[model samples]
Target chain A: MPEDSKRPDEKNLPRFRPATDILERADGFYLYLDLPGVSRENLVLDVKDAELMVSGRTDYRFEPEERLLESEFGNVEYVCSFTLSDIVDAESVTANLRNGVLEIFIPKTSKTIPRRIQVEYQGE
Target chain B: MVIDFGGFGRPYRLINELWKPSFLSQQSLAYPPLNLSENASAIYVRAEIPGVGPDDLDLVLTEKNLIVKGERRVEKGRYFRQERPAGGFQRMVALSAPVDADNVRALLRDGLLTVVLPKAQPKSPRKILVQHG
Candidate 1:
């Protein structure tokens, strides 16, 4: 957003915490992060110490010869982390990046799913 | 200045993260952040909008302004926690130097939209020296 560049210098650009969506279903939990202008080569996805970390650098600067007319955004990093729950299968986790959107699938070990128990009749 | 906690920060270092300025007063933050730059030949306008294809975007070029209108198509159904912005959005960027609208070129890749607008050559009359003969 234009909120990125309040100051003129690129050094003042704040690290943008990308907007994300977390969804839970029967199979697993899903995370969708919006990281624009960040290519796959510049993206980093790490799962360590029971934490899920997603970060990327946006190389938005133009050539040195180009003069900036209006600077709303600049070279800023996008970072966000989440503590993985016990049910999350960190080893089996998979991620995909497409059209600047990062999707992470955190499959559960059949734990997050609710199961119905049938009661037996013991009438005498 | 941005303070980086390295790649992955401490797990407990997320109390103030969820309550971002985006969730509060969204009006202050413009949608689809744009960066405008210019060289001798053309002016470049770059916008970051994920999940939006070229067909979804519409551009209207004027001598002094460029109106960008687009829709970010999103997956249907319901999401337990929805944060990423969806739906239609538009922005108008003012241009200082007149641009050749006919030659403007727009390209979309990896969700980043870059528009190159060639500057129109100045048509002002050239100064002539009038020497007495």
Candidate 2:
């Protein structure tokens, strides 16, 4: 289903409380997400308008008939949202998830870049 | 040092001293391994939070500190005895430098949480050109 059509009433839905880092460079920005237990298989990254959506699930439960020893953790899931600023180039955004970390790179718009003015040299 | 109280009057101090090491050991054992570094521009934190999902974690930022809290729910299988403590935990740290709270990011990879905190604008480096005579 499209992320924009997603209403507030989805069950088994991942909850989002974003913890993101923004690294500004001469040309762009890097946004990193701490989404643990999320695999590349279950991870979803979506862009809607100026908002970025990140959601996933972590499955740790085994078969019911299996022998159990210790258990403190329950099922795992993820839900986080980011509202990007105008400086972000939404079209150029790219995301990658490796070893549970989700990294999104957003290149800055041309307007955000500093333009250098040419210096004129007059012949004496 | 050993102090024997009469009959059932065991020295509470003695019990405390004896169990102090044990209690310390349990706490040390329960704590996750963590490493942190900071510079004028940002603070970096890495924590080992294995088998936990994003929903199990919480991140908070205050005036001078950042807190990471979450629960690790270990699954129980059949025919086994449970021993390890599960549920959740929390850790708070005072930052080494003032950060641009508007631009903080966190990533979880391979059971590790990595946070990158950007420093305020004034804390950034200024380029100075040298003029020679």
Candidate 3:
């Protein structure tokens, strides 16, 4: 069925919530999202107003002549967002998509990193 | 972890439930989502599987059923949110009709696994001629 033919209430198709994993390390945080069938061209990643948003669309089309016996693979659009904290340096964040998985690295500022301090005794 | 005891222990159970791995759920353990389509001479089955490589998949085809088995490994990381299940899966799909297993072609692309099974012979509707009395 064509998307436009659907009623207004159904116009917005169901979006798939991609499962994400967030790991906090000493230097920074790493974010991973499982997005199968999504290509690099279809992915959109942006940080606006301290919010990190990731979205993508999967491309799967069926021929008109094909008869569907059973259907479970529906059209899915991936959408997820997270609020970034002050410690995350959004400007220096990097992302890479490989094998249907996306990985984002958010580096922390130098001030947030822990540093060791040494003290010398001055009393005799 | 701090335990909450004010609300009849409901919150604690919820937290404990959330901590469990999602693959333990019955729905996911049953089978992965699949779609089946057929045409005049072939049957096509598509399964939605993300983060699984082609090498990890194992397939067994018979005249009546197609068994798909594979595992999606959990990547090494500290997970803040884990919704997608990571574990082994086995699904045996019953074919509507007998198929030629030798001619079956399977393709995995974009995390969608599609198997095309050709029929032994094309079955076409026959047109019978009307006899005049």
Clashes per candidate (backbone, < 3 Å):
0, 29, 0
Off by more than 4 A, model 2: A1-18, A63-72, A112-124, B1-133
How far off is residue A90 in model 3, in Å? 1.6
The predicted structure with the larger lDDT, 2 or 3, is 3
Among all candidates shown, the one with the greatest DockQ: 1
Candidate 3: residue B16 lDDT (0-100): 35
Q: Rank the candidates by TM-score, best first.
A: 1, 3, 2
Model 2 Cα lDDT, one tens digit per residue, B1-133: 0111112332322233234343343333443434455555567765657556678889899988888898866432221222233577887777766788999999776676777787777746879999998
What are the chain A TM-scores for all the models, listed individually? Answer: 0.73, 0.66, 0.74
For TM-score, the strongest prediction is: 1
Clashing pairs in 3: none
Kindly list the per-residue Cα lDDT of model 3 for residues B1-133, writing each as its tens digit: 0111112322222233234464234433355677778887888887878767888899899768999999988756665656566789989888997788789999886677889998777468899999998
Candidate 2, residues A1-124, lDDT tens digits: the string is: 1122122233553343333444554556655555555678777888888778777765432222332222112233556566676766889898887555576777777776455689999999
DockQ for every model comes to 0.37, 0.05, 0.27
Cα shift from native, residue A18, model 3 (Å):
1.8
- Tens digits of lDDT, candidate 1, A21-100: 77776677877888887889889998887878888877665655787765545566777887776666778999998888
Of models 1 and 2, which has the larger TM-score? 1
Cα distance off (Å), candidate 2, residue B80: 46
Candidate 1 Cα deviation (angstroms), residue B60 = 1.8
lDDT (tens digit, per residue) of candidate 3 on A1-90? 224212223435446567676777666777778787787888899988677888887776664567876554455667777777766787
